[model samples]
Target: MKMYLISDNVDTKTGMRLAGVEGVVVHEMEEIRNALDEALKDRDIGIILITEKLGKLIADKIKDIKLNYHTPLIVEIPDRHGTGRTPDSITKYVREAIGLKI
Candidate 1:
């Protein structure tokens, strides 16, 4: 299972490359869509890492893809600017998903 990264900046791309994860830096929605399409067509790719900013930019499309496919699992990660998520977002999401406060 190979992991591919879709980065919003050269910084993230370079960092991931140093970690041995190959990636492409793209700044537009069309480019994201194209990269995702290409990645999906690749049977070898089992995971995709996308920057938070670009992930938010294409949230709807990504949601649909996640629901429709089970292979390439798409994961959103923080970029050079760090995560855009609120400090409590994970706790809040966990609470919402299973009705737990912790």
Candidate 2:
């Protein structure tokens, strides 16, 4: 299985690069979408870590992709210069998983 790093900033890519993740791909919304589609076409990608900012911008598209594909596990992480987590994001997923508010 392979991992992918998707971000829109240079710092994020640099950090991932330093961490030995040479497959880091930096792109804007449309380009990111196209790149992700092409990457997902391959069967080796098991995890895709996306920056939260970009994820928010393309939430609908991500949701659609998730529903359609099962090989690549999509996870949202904070960008190098953004909040790592949000209360709303946490609560929403928690509520959906447990059927209760935390």
Candidate 3:
């Protein structure tokens, strides 16, 4: 299984390329959808890494894919600009999920 990336910028794509990951850079919603479709169709691709900016553009679609599919896990990744999440996002998520303060 291989990993594929869908980045929003050339710099992020270039960096991933250096790490031996192949991907496309798309900014528009249609282009992001097409890239995701192509990646999902490939049996060899087991993981799909998409930039957080692009992920926010189609959060509902990403949620649906994650809920329905068993293959090609989709992950939201930070781009060259860094993560959009707050430093305590994970802690908040954990607290929310288990109803416990950590």
lDDT of 3 at 59: 96
Which candidate leads the pack in TM-score?
3
Question: Stretches of candidate 3 above 4 Å error?
Answer: none
Residue lDDT tens for model 1, 27-92: 878999999889999999999999999899999988998999988899999999999999999999
lDDT per residue as tens, model 3, 1-102: 999999999998899999999999998999999999999899999999999999999999899999999988999999878899999999999999899898
lDDT of 3: 0.94
- The most accurate candidate by lDDT is 3
Pitting candidate 1 against candidate 3, the one with the higher lDDT is 3
- All candidates: CA RMSD (Å): 0.9, 2.2, 0.9
Whole-model Cα lDDT of every candidate shown, in order? 0.93, 0.78, 0.94
lDDT per residue, candidate 2, 1-102, as tens digits?
A: 877778887788788888766455556677888767776886877888788887887899789878987779988778868775766987998899899988
- Model 2 C-alpha lDDT versus the unseen true structure: 0.78
Q: Give the clashing residue pairs of candidate 2, or none.
A: none
Ranking by TM-score: 3, 1, 2
